[model samples]
Target chain A: MSFDLGLVIEYFPRLLSGAGLTVELIAISSLVGICIAVPVGLMRVSASPTLRNLSLAYVFFFRGTPLLIQIFLVYYGLSQFEAVRNSVLWPFLRQPYWCAIVAFALNTGAYTAEILRGAMQAVPRGEIEAARAFGMSTALLFRRVILPRAVRIGWPAYGNEVIFMIKGSALASTITLLDLTGMARTIIAKTYAPVEIFLAAGLIYLAIVFVLTRAFRRIEARLNRYLLHESA
Target chain B: MFDLKGFGDQLLLGALMTVGLALSVLCVGTILGLAGAIAKLSKSAPARFAAETYTAVLRGIPELLIVLVIYFGSSGLLTAAAEAMGHDGFVELSPFAAGVTALSLVFGAYATEVFRGAILAIPKGQIEAARAIGMNRRLVFLRVTLPQLWRVALPGLGNLFLVSQKDTALVSVIGLEELTRKAAFATGFTKAPFTFYMAAAVLYLTITSVTMVGLHLAERRASRGMPGMRG
Candidate 1:
């Protein structure tokens, strides 16, 4: 049987909207994820035993299990609890969109935290000693020296997390969130042409990933250039 | 309000199924990865391009989408082909076959990079020495290259295997009765989502931890005679 290229063109518009939702899911989740990750990452590197262990446990659990299971736990398990259902948070938890966001955010946050923590630990010890010799306060030292260096070190791996999140956002479809993959699945159901619709969806994902990969590479190069001795 | 009761055996069986699926996918993926790494390293332009395209496309797409597409897409293609051949019956992929194929493709794409890196890590001098000793190409590869390749690739391959194992859960969406699907089934019957999901998570963590320990031991063993290797 021949493939009709026309189907791809005709469905392109719908796929674009689907891609928009995917981008929204990824953008919102990643922003929220980074917000959560910074504190957790910092805590993971903190001197306090309690904070470090707590963050370690959080990362361990999230990274250990599959994202699909986490989504279901949030979407289904939380709703199962009578107290959770009656709580003020229930309104947000009731929606599949919110559940997806929460799950995605937490999952990405765990990964981003680990990346950031690794980067933070990789910062030159002598540089930190130099900063301390200057009598910089903890806050000033962190803001002026550690944070920027950590980000530069972590950016490439963090970029991988972002790419992974884009792919992970496809799981929103499983929870009935009508994201990119969801829309593709819907179209396939209506047209019974899985080959065409899914190919279109996969291609859309490929395009987005290709662009992101290129952007990250450029950013990494710029970051590397800043670190060169001659440039200094 | 949590009780697993009779579902214990089912969950255990599901874990076995998950392991079986992952292992099968690993074997298929390792074969694909070897082929892909060779293609990527080949002198021919077309071979390198094909390998690059394979990794780029497969790695870029979500594994969930791949599973869905392969499950439904192949069935449609197969049915159409059957019809063209004057057959009248339905042609569908069992979820196991589709899951294995999709996961293998996913694992293979990622493993290609790891294998390629491992191959590159082998010293060129060693291969040259083998050639100078008058060993045939196949013998040189088997005796010199293969032994060293596995040592370098083990850690990365192990990590990919962990990812692949968790990905088996995604196949549940297409109706494979792996751990996640088994948990979903239990939740539907017992209406105890928290219990089932929590149990599934624990089960997965157990598998992950055990595998990590095994990999660490294997890595230590592999690095035993190497200089400056640390635990």
Candidate 2:
């Protein structure tokens, strides 16, 4: 059959709303994930063996398993426990939306922690020494010298984590969140036109990811303007 | 509160299927990656653009959507094309085939970058030296390029395969009876979601750790007798 433009136009609003929920899901989870990552990452690089090993275990467990299983475990598995159901946290855990956020945040947190840890280690030792030589306190040294440099060095990879989180947010659909893919699946069920509906869905994702990557590239360039002169 | 009795066989079967699917995808992905790298490196502008777009589009989209589209969409397209070719039958795309195709496409897109880097890492003078020794193009590639490319690409490809292994779980969404699906199935009957999923997670972790050890051994083997190489 030939292509039908009419279906796409008719379904655009529904698809747009789905995309909105997707954006909402991604934005909130990624923000929480980054917040989680920063502390975990710091803990990873800390001198204390207890802290470092605990952070390493956290990263290992999350990174080892598939995200799909993680989502199922949180969404379906957690509710299986009577203690959890009777607890004050049950209200939040009962919702698929919250379960998704929990899973995405935890999973991305593990990855971002590793990225930040690598970036922290990669920061030039000389710069760190200079700050110490000036008698900057540990807090001041990290605030003024370490974090800024680590973030600049790790931003590109962190940008990748953002894109991954977006792509990953699609998994929320599987848990009944009615995100972009969920909307597309619903539309296809009604119209019996999987190709057209899914293509539209895919293109919308492409556009968002395209915009995100471009924005990241600009930020990376702006961050490294000082190094640009030497390279050119 | 947990029992795996009588479910062990099913889980084993599912894990085997997971490995089988991963291997199929790896073969397809490596071929596509090699071809994609060549196209991107080629002089033809159209080839370069096509390769670039392939990687960008595949990498940009969600792997689940790709699997859904290929599994559900291909049947209609294939049937239409079959009719156009004077055939008169409904064509069905197996979930296995669709899963393999989709997973491989995702695998290949990332692999393209790995292969491209590996290829570029081979120095120009080495190829020139091989040519100067009167070696043909095929001999040069087999004797020089292929060996170095394997060493350089192994770590990246090993990581990709592990990621792809987890991705194989996504195929369960499209009705493949892989590890994740089987776990879900058992969870349904036993009403023990945590037990089954945790078991599946441990199984996956086992596969990952085993493959990692294998990869470590392979890296050591490849690096043997080479200066500056580490264990």
Candidate 3:
């Protein structure tokens, strides 16, 4: 019933070891998510109804459902089919690690795409018109004018999604990956000290979030440096 | 090719439970959020510090860890308390109670910011006018502050509802027989993981879509007569 400081100190290193996979899951999924998001986000605002609708559906389905179910669909559901089990994709699909990555990437991609779409739309229309007035091509205008402004606008929200991704990656533990939560569960099973182990795990997560928050604030400051004098 | 094996009713019940749990958490969370917002905005430094710590710690950690910690930790505390009371047995917290506590904490943390922003969005002149008209603090809040707060807070709260609804799936890990757990059960029973999970996903989407429509209508109603406001 009492707090077990000694037990937490003992198992702190074991919990810290799982930080690697947690960081890896966030990094790879975030990288892959950006790849999917940029295109899908662009498609979201495209003039073509078909492309816009397709991306809309993608974002809708992914955003509408839970990430846990998505992970289950990939990890447990995919292997249920004879075709998927025998397909070339089976090798990667068979691993829970890859499945978690796929689910996280797709989930974050949907959220980021929405954020990107909003940010892109919110880009000052006059800026785009000015780029056109300068005779910049569509691609050049998007690259120089729209994307940078959208990034500046979307960066804070994207940072939130990343933090959510970090929290969500803990669900990867449910599928048996030895992430921080998984490790905490494992140690608790052996030591019968759920409170201590989970407290330690929570501390580690808090540390990760704290560091990321500071990093995001720094990036936001850098991005908005030009607007500083106006605000002052 | 995709039969539910007559578990359709089971899944429906589970979906209902999911909705019920989400609504309950939303109600509790909204109250906590309001209190947290007031505390944060209050002049008392200790009250603000406590509210700040509450949101910071709850928002920073994973909901899963919260669920696990509460599920296990509360039981341990309860059993110890029971032993001190001369009862010699283990005490367990029900999955429902644990689920509600954990999810509400998470929901309330995010909702605090939403409510705080909504509260701050109210024009200072309105509160001043109410006070100038001899309204007490409580009456001013009820008649003046609460009405406008909902208009601004509805959208954010709606989004949080969607989030908490999906987060109900996380409670399944603690053995709550919500939609996700029912699908998992059916999957085990029928050995049809894909069919059941896909069905669950569809069920979730249905709930989400319905909630979205409902929120849209609510927002429209709440923002009625507000000039230049987009419903």
Write out the backbone clash pairs for model 2: none
Interface RMSD of each: 1.5, 1.2, 1.1
lDDT of predicted model 3:
0.93
lDDT per residue as tens, model 1, B4-106:
8688888988888998998999999999998899889988999999999999999999999899889978887889989999998889789999999999999
lDDT per residue for candidate 2 within A173-200, as digits (tens), equals 8788899999988898899877788888
Model 2 docking tier (incorrect/acceptable/medium/high)? medium
Q: Which digits, one per residue and each the tens of the lDDT, describe model 2 over residues B1-231? A: 448857877888999999999999999999999889878987899999999999999989989889988998788789999999999999977999999999999999999999999989999999999999999977987899878998889999998999899899999989999999999999888888988998999889888888889999998888778768674
RMSD of each: 2.5, 2.1, 2.0
lDDT of 2: 0.91
Residue B91, candidate 1: Cα error in Å is: 7.0
Candidate 3 residue-wise lDDT at A98: 95
Task: Please list the C-alpha lDDT of all candidates, in the order they appear.
Answer: 0.91, 0.91, 0.93
TM per candidate:
0.93, 0.94, 0.96
Output the better candidate (2/3) by DockQ: 3
Looking at model 1, give its docking quality level: medium
Go through the candidates in order and give each one's DockQ.
0.73, 0.77, 0.81
